[model samples]
Target: MAPENTPVHIIQLIKEITGFIQKGSPITYLGCPLYIGRQRIIYYSDLVAKVMKKISGWQSKILSVGGRATLIKHVLQSISIHNMAAISPPKTTIQYMKRVIADFLWGWDKEKKKISLGILGNS
Candidate 1:
């Protein structure tokens, strides 16, 4: 069973990933005249907000289901979206950024024996 509470490593990982992604394409506000000579990048807030909305909807659907395993299966099946979307945004894509962020924040990384330990307390 998944533990209750956010994980630290996952949080770190999320911060890292968010940093990496944002670094590659730093978003600039539209009509902002301060970047007249600079190249414009995609906005992180807009991308993140959209991704959050998609994940929120997905979580609601998962809750509607009765079984944890079913939720896991569905999530696994959609894992590709999570990884790919991080690198490239697609049209009408509902990537699983939330799950990735949540897992890194709360899930166990058994290989490294590193648990998030946000609320689980030194697993």
Candidate 2:
């Protein structure tokens, strides 16, 4: 691919990563420390951390190609757009369409099950 197109590809990857994080199923759930004894939050934080690490590793790789800073900037910009799209209405609706397409290409429950197993341990 052309050097200029690298930024666009990185942006698209960021968008995909954001959507995956926001809508992906919880990996684990534990009752709240207080409040309802059964309240739980998605264990997505770990997944996010892993993605960050991957990006950092990718950044190192990009540095060798001399596109490190530009790629990082583009990825961040795309993540901002994706974060907004994931929360708001019209954009969120569009993401749903994208998710449908992605699901068709990659099995619907594949990532969900993988993440769940990673977090919940073998039980």
Candidate 3:
């Protein structure tokens, strides 16, 4: 893709020669955002939503602590590995993912208790 100010005729000529379709910015390629300019949390917001959805889906079940930990280690971590390998996500995204995982692991609704960051790190 060309820059924003690139001439339309040039783009057409390139497309005609290369036979590659032109698409607008902010497109997703391989589950990652492909866009011009600086990277922002907006681009990775979907990743957070996806993790939240996956965790929230299992909230109805009465899972043991081991089951929850296993899900977090295998499923929740796997979802973000693909995107994380490609780009540096914002701090907020990482923090949100951690919070969701921790909440799911410790049974947030029933106990309504908090886990310290140190305990989380050891686990």
Predictions in order: lDDT: 0.41, 0.38, 0.79
Question: Could you tell which candidate, 2 or 3, scores higher by lDDT?
Answer: 3
Candidates ranked, most accurate by TM-score first = 3, 2, 1
Of candidate 1, the 10-residue stretch with the lowest lDDT total is 31-40
Q: Return the TM-score for candidate 1, rounded to 2 decimals.
A: 0.24
- Choose 1 or 2, whichever is better by TM-score: 2
User: Which residue pairs in candidate 2 have backbone atoms (N, alpha carbon, C) closer than 3 angstroms, thus clashing?
Assistant: none
Model 1 CA deviation exceeding 4 Å by range:
1-42, 60-100, 103-123
Q: What lDDT tens digits, residue by residue, belong to model 1 across residues 1-123? A: 223576867766877877743223343333121222333234333545544454555544335323423453455335444534444433233233434444533333545554332331222
Residue-level lDDT tens digits of model 2 in 1-123: 235656776766876887743233333223111222332322223323433554545525325322533443455334435434443324333344333323322334664632221111122
Q: Highest TM-score: give the candidate number.
A: 3
**In candidate 3, what are the lDDT values of residues 1-123, reduced to their tens digit?**
689999999999999999989776678888888878988878887788888889878963589877887888788888989998998788777887787788778767755676644433433
Of the two candidates 1 and 3, the one with more favorable TM-score, higher being better, is: 3
- TM-score, each model? 0.24, 0.26, 0.70
